[model samples]
Target: MKMLLLRYSTAFICAVFIITGAVSGEDKAVGQTVSFRPDKIVTPVSSIIWKHRSSTGSVVKAIEWDVDDGDNIPNPRFKGITTLDQKTGEITITKLTVEHSGVYTIDINSKEHEQRFTLNVMERVPKPEITIEESSNPDVVYLRCAYSEKIIWKKSSGETLNGMKNQDPGEFITVKNTRNPENFYTCTLKNAVSEEISDPVTERELFGTGEDKAVGQTVSFRPDKIVPPVSSIIWKHRSSTGSVIKVIEWDAEDGDNIPNPRFKGITTLDEKTGEITITKLTVEHSGVYTIDINGKEHEQRFTLTVMERVSKPKMTIEVSSNPDVVYLRCAYSEKIIWKNSSGETLEGKKNHELGEFITVENTGNPENFYTCTLKNAVSEEISDPVSEREIFRTGEDKAVGQTVSFRPDKIVTPVSSIIWKHRSSTGSVVKAIEWDVDDGDNIPNPRFKGITTLDRKTGQITITNLIIEHSGVYTIDINSKEQEQRFTLTVMERVPKPKMTIEVSSNPDVAYLRCAYNEMIIWKNSSGETLNGTKNHDPGEYIMVKNTRNPENFYTCTLKNAVSEEISDPVTEREIFGTGSNAGMIVAIVIVVFIVIAVIAIVLSYLIMKTVHESVNNICPCIPNIFGPLDCLLKKTDREPKNSAPNDVASPLNETAP
Candidate 1:
């Protein structure tokens, strides 16, 4: 009985230890989320209850849910921060704090599950800093860390110093001066939840480091040491070719002086510290610099390489004969790099072929953008983003007489050279317009002589007074790269307005109506019905119609082409007949009136002539002479005896006339 009791007690204690060891715990930073899930699967009808034990050992029911009653949280503090999943029996707490850190347990269907969680919320460790302190030895210093938590010392390469992982909480560590320019160190504050690392400090920063500068940049050089009340200071520069130039000269009484003309206006000197600063540096200012104090040179010398800033890069695209390949060339530079839209560097030989330019395959995706960067030691410039889609475009359809303009998707400014070509419908190509920096616009084809205009800056061509012959493919080449996009144009003709005319036959009742236009003609009556007509002299130029006396029976002629249509003014049949009859009657009346007036004038002329002749005979009884004077008057004046009988008759006539 004693052995049985001892074995049962031991078994009970072992079971309790196993149950306690089943709970899980994790360390979470402040403001982080933690989740506790039940070990067994949860069903819709299963009841769930969640409870939490605070750090102070107080227990409380946090949430309760079942199929009958939805879900309820008793504690208002956890109202917004806690979420419960009824189906999965998962409890999630967000934005956790130290006050909320405790053990969490879930009971499903009135039975506590084996799954348990303990959350330990902690704040992030403070960032560690290395405070340097002077040691008694001249060649050594003490680097002290400042943090409440564990300290981790690392070199610039991220390796632990002296192969030590986490160091015990300590204040300072001794370091010997190595005089190596590549030496750098950092410290980190680490905890269970989070860690913070300090910025890297280099040994050269404590000493002095050489600098590289570009044009228009400023630089300062400080000596290693300077005695108080320095008598004289001189800053000197030595070029790479071993030529020395006096950069600055200063004295206690004589002030400062800069002898070099290149550093006259842009150089400054500190007399007390023997320090010199050069502003607005140029490439010519590149050299080894040093300072002198009290007739003795400073210990350290600074070497500076002043380079020119990189020029702004320009991108040019060239399309290959293959539709899927394109070449991108950047402005000339010693070093070039290519990048995609996502800012990832592309492999040189794998992703693109390297030559004078970069060649890439067009995958027909416009989202794949590329940029080129021109880089040197001092500066870099990136070109604008370019895509293959921007280098090619589709065609447009246009009307026959429209003034059309062909604009490229991408316009290269400051264009050095450009050429515009056209492919006719018969597969013949010709240069429409060309221009270059040396020569102005030159139009080679006579057809485009007066109508084509090319833009020098945009590489665009505008063709005015467009004709049917201009309906072909047009292309442009800028800086020797022919564009793949073709401006295909289809020109259609427009119909003109139609005119109607009437002609009369020999018969009074017969009249013909004609419609005049150089296109398909449709004849419509007043009832809006199509009429058939015989073809006229030319195709689609004329239409015929018969004349009707009805006033309401009006006719219209419509001229139509593939692109346009126009209708003539409505004309009535009675108007047509009236036109012919009125014209004929007017002619007949004009002829009859003219003949009557002519006959009356002839009768009056004859009567007047007879009266005149009788009067002449009564007056002189002789005819008038044609070339000479009257013969009877002449005879009467010449001889009176021969004209005695005439004189006696004339005397009786003259008396009667008087």
Candidate 2:
């Protein structure tokens, strides 16, 4: 209980001091956030008021309140920009601008309940830099840590030195520098609001590792010891000619560092440790490097080699004159090897060929994929997977004679070279051409020598007399100084329209549709469902439409061959119906002919009876006579009914008069 009371008393005393002039100011960088309260304990708070005072003891923002006059009214000028916590009386200001830098006071409920917070929002202090200075003692290094803020010297491992942090700017730190290769130190700068750790200052060394890098790259080396009082340090390169050349020289005694004229602008040397950096390294820089420290007493050697970077190799299947053979060609500027997916090496038994061409026989494999690996002294490049299907079966068409052309969407400048290839699946690549702009003409493979023409201006190529075997993707790759163009050429099979017809059988009451072609076929209804039982749809099979519904909107027939598909237009039942049987139509014609004959005979009999009635008056009904009217009436008696003729006797009289 007494300890708790003592803690409260101490805090109360501090609060009283803040109200008086005895409050010591806290450090805060300008434009940084800082918060202070009456204490860390919560008390009864009704309303919160905040105040801002400048560093010069001038009150800037007069007042702010969470609740005043029974309304939660804040100062209207900065309304919604600042907020006060009524419960804790803590004022939070975000995005602290420069003008918000100063002492901040908070009043809880009334002006008497006041607390102070010193805020100075300022920029972060820059990191401290330690540069080596001359030291008389050979084992010690005189160093200065430079910073504008309160600086503290520390070991690079984050260990603080005794009383080193309290030192003023430009003050030097003294320590024994041993021959232990790695001595790293740094400094930390701080203010009320910001702090930063400087870059590490490690003691310079005298030796660097041997390295092998590509030409036109940077080469750097660091030594093991970089202490002050370095009497003389010189970097020398041992050239391939077995002669030593001075690259750079530094002498504490001479008060200057001098570099050799041969490496005037291409070399850089660290003043402290004698390390060297060479930019834009070339073949000439490949040699042994030596650092001579303290008049050659401590020397280290580093070996380096500058080699060329290898270009990536690209693989292409070229068409050979033999329809059953293809050539695998690789394009690169270094050594290359051709390898199949099974890891069998096809080429590269000897040195790498820039443009290597290998004749490959078509082996009827579904997948014939290959890759070309290019290698140089410094690097390796592998190409994309090249396959036979992508080469031979691309575009899936074949014609008797077709013109195949390849063109990329965009052509770039500096056209250095190009390659055209037509690879076949069943055969080898029929044609391959390696076109070099510098060579003025292309040396095409024997097969396509006379059939290929290239347009260098547009990077397009045309091949004439394209046959079925030539129905594959022709790849055109052009090499520019800055880019490569890949054009796709697909040759499709030219197929004709198929003969399709719908047939109906009246006897069986069924419909039969067939897509007649000398190839494999499949029939589909308007809704695209397969007719009959379909299995593997192999090409060149006799396919007919089965189990069909008559009067279909459309029955499409697709005839497929080895490399092409021919779909026939819809053959409706109306167009090809009644060919199977005509019994129903023949019976209907017979019935109609019989009915017409009966009607004609009846009409003639009625006319004869009427004439007889008009001529023989009342004699026919009573007695049989040998006259024309009596004979006609007797002959027609079986054919004409008694009531067959109409009762109009005037017609007969008028006919006789005419």
Q: Residue pairs in steric clash, candidate 1?
A: none
Error of 1 at 37 (Å): 5.1
lDDT of candidate 2 over 317-415, digit per residue (tens): 778786557777786657677788788877543325556777666454436777888875467889888765555432323455666666655677777
The candidate maximizing lDDT is 1
Q: What TM-score does structure 1 among the candidates reach?
A: 0.38
The per-candidate count of clashes, in order, stands at 0, 39
Candidate 2 residue runs with Cα over 4 Å from true position? 1-208, 225-229, 255-259, 297-299, 316-322, 331-333, 337-347, 351-368, 394-658
- Against the reference, the lDDT scores of all candidates come to 0.75, 0.62
Worst 10 residues of 1 by lDDT: 347-356
TM-score of each: 0.38, 0.28
Question: What is the per-residue lDDT of model 1 for residues 339-442, given as tens digits with 9 covering 90 to 100?
Answer: 88778776443234332466777554555788888776578888888865565434544567677788787876667889999899999999999998898989
Model 2 is weakest, by summed lDDT over 10 consecutive residues, at 648-657
